[model samples]
Target: MRTLRRRMGLLVVPVLGLGLVGCCGSGERGSDASAAAAGFERAISTGDTAAVCAALAPESLSEVEESGKAECADAIPESRLPVGGSVRTVDVYGRQARVVLASDTLFLSQFTDGWKVVAAGCRLRAGHPYQCAVKGG
Candidate 1:
């Protein structure tokens, strides 16, 4: 009986350790992505253009600057992205995320620093990707 119990303990310990390792990274990443999305929404509602610009991904900031011939901080508010309601849901996959608000949809990407907004004020189009007022492209 003692030998059988010891064998079971060996199997259980390794299984439990692997399970913990699998969950730890993913759980933290999901929460971090959601917080970044919520913070972006708050910046828009408060008319904090600088904060909004800071929340944008590098590619998105470049797109804004190139298209408007203005700095990202100056151009972000001028884009007039729809101010959606509170965040309803955040979905994360690998390095990408989608956040749904009451009146708008936002896409985000994970960077070395953290998550950043890649698109905002997006609407669905038949058989196409979302059409966004502010997008990385």
Candidate 2:
């Protein structure tokens, strides 16, 4: 009986350790997503084009810049930006994560930098998607 109890204890210790590790990892991911969302909100509020651009994905930046409709440095109006939203849910796989925000708009992509806004507008469109656009610096 003593030997059986000892063996169970050993198994329990490893299971508890693994559980702790999993919780820590999940917490870190949540913190990252929260920080990214907060940064985006703050940048938009302050009209910090640089901050906003920095948070964007590389391909997105290039596409917006090349389109010529708007530049990355443009200040986004308060109306166009999200006011309050929490990370409703976050799905992560490897270096990428997709976070669902509580705002009216929907942002896509699994970003290592958390959930950055890939696209936003009153309505999602195919060709002419509405996002923060700025002209020449």
Candidate 3:
């Protein structure tokens, strides 16, 4: 039993390491993700409705539209998203990414065109996934 447990531990270590590496990703992907998050903040701050809606993922756009009963640009501005300040950290795994900002955290997914915000204005909750002001259903 001890030997079997040791072998299992060895197997788990490499898999876990890979997962961590994938989560951290490389500078290039991380940079892109960071840029996307920063762009969203800029658009929002500038009150550029088109750019703001363009930054959002399709599912998120749909949620805001359905819930607000208005266009993406109109609804998103009224969603009360927190001001996402400077990009602090960017983590990527496969097609998904999370950009942690000074005031907020944004979850993004890689789309055909580019990275889009799947969720934004997120705050960490103890023992739970992030609670986001902007997210799909």
- Give the candidate number with the greatest TM-score: 3
Task: Please give the CA lDDT of all the candidate structures.
Answer: 0.71, 0.46, 0.74
Q: Model 2 clash pairs? A: 71-134, 97-110
lDDT string for model 1 (53-94, tens) is 999998788878887789988877667888878777665656
Answer with 2 or 3, whichever has the higher TM-score.
3
The positional error of residue 135 in candidate 2, measured at the CA in angstroms, is 18
Scored by lDDT, the top model is: 3
Regions of candidate 2 where Cα sits further than 4 Å from its true position: 1-25, 75-81, 104-137
lDDT of 3: 0.74
Q: What is the descending lDDT order?
A: 3, 1, 2
After TM-score superposition, the amount by which residue 80's alpha carbon in candidate 2 deviates from its true location, in angstroms, is 4.0
Off by over 4 Å in 3: 1-22
Q: TM-score: which is higher, 1 or 2?
A: 1
lDDT of 2 by residue, 1-137 (tens): 01101131121112222223223325676567556756665676677878877766665566446654557675344225454455565543344333445663323344554565554332323443323332111
